[model samples]
Target: MSLKGVELQIAIPKTFDAGKMADQHHQKTINQQLDANEALNREIERKQLAVNKSEGMDAISEEDENDASNNGQTSSEQNKKKKQQQEQDAQHPFKGNLFDFSG
Candidate 1:
């Protein structure tokens, strides 16, 4: 018998671990679900922030309008006070004509 013509045969058994595969599949599904939930939460927070920003802008505009109206009223009241002062000055021309030098 020559060494080049000699051959050896060996038997090896193949096995499948079903439980380990199932556990791996289950963990993959759980990770996917967690990722989806995180994405959904981020979307909800973004929409809520947008709504709050819009509401804040609306409140600021309303306050500006009220301030404008109040300013108009204040100007009218100032005009009335000036007219009253002018009438009083006309009635008593010498009331404030002399300055008090004693102070």
Candidate 2:
């Protein structure tokens, strides 16, 4: 017996596109990252505004304090003490001389 000719056929099912799935996942991650960055920027701007408003008030208070200190008697006794300390500091700015400073 001899099998001279035969017709054989094989079919393989198509596989899913792994690369397309990966691309979709990447796009989703990028969108999420962009949203996070925008939110962070908004928060930073809000914090800067708060800091500026507070610093402005602080500067005004310091200016008022400076004006109050021009006279001999200050608005608070603490200011008087600070003035006395400043005068003492002007006379002897450092407890030890520069030659005696280790650091």
Question: What are the Cα lDDT values of the candidates?
Answer: 0.70, 0.70
The TM-score between candidate 2 and the true structure equals 0.39
- The backbone clash count of each candidate, in order, is 0, 0
lDDT of 1 by residue, 1-103 (tens): 4323223221111123566678899999999999999999999998877755467787678757756666757767867865886686478656757888899
In angstroms, what RMSD does candidate 1 have relative to the true structure? 17.1
C-alpha lDDT of residue 101 in model 1:
81
Tell me the RMSD of model 2 versus the true structure. 9.1
Under the 3 Å rule for N, CA and C atoms, how many clashes does model 2 have?
0
lDDT of 2 by residue, 1-103 (tens): 5433342121111123566678899999999999999999999998877745456787679757867776666468667776886787588655556664477
- List all candidate RMSDs to the true structure: 17.1, 9.1
Question: Per-residue error at 51 for model 2, in Å?
Answer: 2.7
**Model 1 clash number:** 0
Model 2: lDDT equals 0.70
